[model samples]
Target: MAVSESDDEGSDRARGKWRAKKKQRPFWQELPILIVIAAVIAALTVSFVGRPYVIPSESMEPTLHGCSGCTGDRIYVQKLSYYWGDPVPGDVVVFVGPPSWNTRYQSIRSDNAVVRGVQNFFSFFGLVPPDENDLVKRVIATGGQTVQCCDDQGRILVNGKPLDEPYVKSDFAWVSGQQNATYPSGRVFGPVKVPDGNVWVMGDNRNHSADSRAHVSDELQGTVPLDNIRGKAVFKIWPPGRIGPVRAQDPQQN
Candidate 1:
């Protein structure tokens, strides 16, 4: 059957109007929903999967830098790694500082409620550093193992054997005896045994780090409980040149 010209023209106009209305819907109307979704995903990932941590001090130098007055490496610490297993020797990790360890670093907190709230909001998504009382170091000795300073060649001894410690800082001044006059003193610490459920940690930059050895007088005797550990540091994700896996060295290889 033949359709009337006027009728066909009316149908075409209706289709065009529908298309225009669809295009006219404001994109801003959907923006808030998208932002909420993104925030939820970020929050979940940070809480359960991983998060970025910026090196804040030179304690873990050469392996992970936080040198004073210099930019530090940004790494992703896997929050779920320790869920199924405990932190073993040679695993770089992040953990909450013990009360005894807390005195070493000055707290950086704002008394203003608004400023503190703002920082807390961003921290939920791993956008900023965690609290000042958090620290990162390599696991040197697990429960039941002994950790001591300085073998015959200044290497740390673990479980009655000297560690290879290829990652240790070996700069000219350190090797020449001009440096390392204090901390790594050839026989500075005892052959202390790690207590059950705790792990002894130290920084790769021995001379510069205030680690387990420095906190021996504390109640935990310089060891952190496994429960205090946040997770293992797995990757360096910043500074293109330094991007790579944060190696977990095997004690057996040394």
Candidate 2:
């Protein structure tokens, strides 16, 4: 049971040498390790915590601006909100487009496998757009609610109550000649009962947006499944003049 001072000193010297070796590692070697760690963290953040999305169309205009030949608004979509509760009416959200809605969506990736692989890697870091058909819209009705267009005052009704949506930017010209426009789009549809676990969504730009209304004949009755929702768009982070929190006004609230 006797421990010698020489043995203890040898053990101490061995540990010191190892520490010195670690400290002497070249920056070039450490750089790769740091890069891999950072990449893993970025990937996880993009997958679960939050990610940035660029608005690709005018559908959410006056709320989120994106159009041809313009700087699109880049929004930060936070996944944490839905982890606490389901999306409510008026929450702006990003979701993968359903099959019916993606009929016209074309992937921007090149056909070459090597190029596509490079594109995929860059996309993981938010350097390039994702190849999927992702869309952004506002929740109009949730599971169990019946949504329909146009009261006498041209308002959308959800569960027999008219929604007061201040964010809507309708093409009033579409209804100009109508005697009493039933809806801003000048087209009437719905009274569609949203299936449980699905949400009826629409764009603020009613006349132009090909949202759930445009896909009503599809298998899911145009309602997006909750599972398709990527995240709640919490803030607009691009176009310095337009930077602000994305509104999540509950249209159902009186």
Candidate 3:
């Protein structure tokens, strides 16, 4: 009788342990569902909403920089900045350009594309992936306006009004673009009017950027169509040392 009773107690103890083990393994069983939900949420976020963008160029200079140059690291771009209004002058912006930038990224990467996507997910949350590449530059002129550089007093002019460009050249170098370039190169413009739905843009580092000031094929030059504007870059939020409001170039300058 004693032996039989002892055997029954051991059996009960084993059953208890089995139940405990099952409870401990709950997350493993539910993991697939959890992953599915997470993936669905991510897809929606990337498709319908803002994804964090990383700057990877010096095209914006004092405004933004990517790892490709001396500017340290990446930043989170608000993809919805243009939903309320068009890009205005002095607004920093990001946009996809010609294959010159994207092709180079493809040539260098060797990792699996899925892994890259996962890394980007972490970047979307501003958590990891300390690197990115999106061009950032300041907008200079909006639609239906005339932009010209070098007033009689060494300032830029927009629609016959002089802009107070404290962030740009007071006597900043007026480096000209290619001889036939449509941008305001070397203070050159026969008063070309920005088209009805385009905005003229120039980098704060006017001499260097290949922005709207750069060539957009043969027919359209000097102005970027409104649809091409990804979003207006508002401020620099990285490096933790330099952060402040991106000031406009005195829109009231007349």
Candidate 4:
């Protein structure tokens, strides 16, 4: 059938209208949409895959630096590792502070709902520090193992065997401003057996760390439940000069 001239004109006009309706959105108008999309994707990545955490103290010093008047090291904690296996002895992990560990914690989060929501969003990208009591430490002993500090050579023992912890730094002359502030070894603690699904952790800056050893009097004997662990710290992502893979050296190997 031969097409009519009027029919052809009508089709052309319809096409023109469709094209006008589908014109590219202005860059400024599209930017907010782009921002929202990026934020959602980033939030999901931080929630399920990995996230960055800034060291808040000297607890894991030398191995992971954070202290007054110093640029804190930001670490990447990957959640996938723990999904396949539990944290083993020597694994550096980020976890929520248990009840006992939070006695001295004071959250910096704002009480105002609007301000807190803004903080929560920025926290995902690490612009703001997390307000919760999150801590990082090395696993000294896993479930069913007995952990205690100090042997004849002043070594921490797990399962009655001394751990050769090369990462431990008892000296703090660089930050503490005292030449004699170093401890020959970490403070002594119990031979408490870690409960099932729990781990005993300690900071690499042994003498200055308020880790599991400081909470032995707690109900769980200071061992953190495995469920409390956020993830294994895989890499140091900040401080250009100090970036490197965070070591999970097996202290029990010795």
Better of 3 and 4 by TM-score: 4
List model 4 lDDT by residue over 106-197, tens digit each. 98889999999999879886567778889999998999999875566666688789889899767323322222212333356687899999
Quality of model 3 by C-alpha lDDT: 0.60
TM-score of each: 0.82, 0.87, 0.65, 0.83
lDDT of 2 by residue, 63-120 (tens): 9999988999999999998998999999999999988999898999999999999999
User: Of 2 and 3, which scores higher on TM-score?
Assistant: 2
The worst-scoring run of ten residues by lDDT in candidate 1 lies at 171-180
Model 2 alpha-carbon miss at residue 14, Å: 12
Candidate 1's error at 95, in angstroms?
Answer: 1.4
lDDT of 1 by residue, 1-254 (tens): 89999999999999999999987857798889899999999999999998888888888878897777777898899978788889988899999888888876764556798998888888888776666577899998899988875555556688778887777774223242332424445335767899999999988877677788888878888899988888889999988888999998855356
Clash number by candidate, in order:
1, 0, 3, 0
Query: Where in model 3 is the C-alpha error above 4 Å?
Result: 1-25, 66-73, 98-134, 169-185, 243-254
The numbered model that scores best in lDDT is 2
The reply for model 1, stretches above 4 Å from the true place, is: 1-25, 171-187
Choose the strongest candidate by TM-score: 2
